[model samples]
Target: MFEPHGPKRLSDIVTGDETWFLFFIIPPKRLNRMWVDGQGDRHVVLRPGFQSRKTMFTVFFNYSGPLVVDILPQDTTMTATYYVQSVLSQVKSVINEQRQKVSTSRTLYLHDIAGPHKARATTQSLWELGIQVLPHPAYSPRLGTM
Candidate 1:
């Protein structure tokens, strides 16, 4: 696991300004819970190829099951800048839409993510987006949980 220290303050989450970049991963089990059924009740179903999902640009597309993807990077890539750009763009869009639904400001606070590439690229990109990046320790689970 590419774990990094967690955030310490509300600003660390960046959501209050209506901008928060909290990264999490959901395996197939949790993915199964969000699926809508024909009857409109959510149910968990066992899918054969759910465990063999593919990771691309932080997206875990499991065809046999739900389509939820883990936004955390599982490994460092050669072209980290591009990867970060793609992930952040998608994340920012979703966040903006959600904030708009609640009529909130789009100013975000991006707590530093744990992965090496995430640390480097996300920080730079978020700064450009006017989100404050909280200071974090090197290897503390407390930061991640917050």
Candidate 2:
């Protein structure tokens, strides 16, 4: 697809990626250990509570570094509508802020081929924002081997 543009400059393209973070942290095992003279006196340690609790963040940037990060609300599932309305719109702000470094009119939007990213509404929203979505291989990282 980039063939039309020929050899491209890093400054001309921007990529967006999303990741999740868990607020809860597990203290180092050594820190949890207590040096007691007797084995029965040793202290016991427990794992973190609510390990599944986490927040998802979408990062948008180019070679210059991160431009924007959107954090999803706790327990919210990312859907197509939510992605376009909340995350996709933020790309505009990133472009506006980095207009001098990036293209003033348009930039390439690279994201995984997830259902939300490929939705018609999302594609349309990107088009309206002067962004062109770069094709990406579809992979479900959540899957497990048979």
Candidate 3:
């Protein structure tokens, strides 16, 4: 659908995704080198078995650069209500501010077919913000190739 419009349409397109980030990263064994005086004095490095502390962040970006990077609150599960009130609200403000030079009347959003992204609340919020979502296929043949 977007093949013919070219650069102007591409520039108005914004895509986003959420990812979990580890708060602590273990150093690689190569970087753990120690200058020990004796050959038998090398200490053992233990690796933790438990899951590391992590934070979830939702990031939005366009052709220009990143527009929003919102950290999900600790212990909070992402839901349609939260997505609309928190993330999309910030997106609306940032889009208005960053895309002021270009017209935002037809800003297009592209995201995966996640539950929250396809929720009714999210759709309503996007419409209220004057942003349109590009249709995403639930299944793609090329998915396995990647």
Candidate 4:
């Protein structure tokens, strides 16, 4: 018996995130949904009393699990130059080592429309690697499934 690749794994659907340790808590929209029959009480998210420091890291993973985690140097800005010069290399290594081998298969890169991710140099870097970019909408959290 053989298993045909269906939706595929991270090769078909993948997510990468560059997060800073900002302590802001955003309540999900579901919190606003209230049953008017008095069956539920209003939910609230309290703001933190003290501001918290932040740390930044870039990570890539898919339905199966995590693939890469690259912590950025403090105060480092992610520009097209920096991304192509640094981030792309790490991602390439992950894809090279962890990606499933299938002939004539397509790899769709589904990163969000972040400034660095969309820069021309970054796009060119991906192009050189023969990875196709997935069209992404800005501010669309639904597309970010990680």
Highest-TM-score candidate: 3
lDDT over C-alpha atoms for residue 9 of model 1: 28
Tell me the spans in candidate 3 whose CA falls farther than 4 Å from its real position: 1-8, 25-51, 101-103, 141-146
Flag regions of model 1 displaced more than 4 Å. 1-79, 101-121, 138-146
lDDT of 4 by residue, 13-34 (tens): 5568798866555556665665
In model 2, which regions exceed 4 Å deviation?
1-8, 25-52, 100-105, 137-146
Q: Rank the candidates by TM-score, best first.
A: 3, 2, 4, 1
lDDT of 2 by residue, 29-99 (tens): 66666667754666556764426467899888888888779998876888899898888677777677668
Better of 2 and 3 by lDDT: 3
Clashing pairs in 4: none
Q: Where does model 4 exceed 4 Å of error?
A: 1-11, 22-52, 103-105, 138-146
Q: Sorted by lDDT, highest first, which candidate order results?
A: 3, 2, 4, 1
Q: Can you give the TM-score per candidate against the true fold?
A: 0.37, 0.68, 0.73, 0.62
Question: Any idea what lDDT model 1 has?
Answer: 0.45
Global fold similarity of model 4 (TM-score): 0.62
Model 3, 31-143: lDDT tens per residue? Answer: 65767885578776575343478899999998888989999999999899998999888888888888687655679889998899999999887887777788876697989
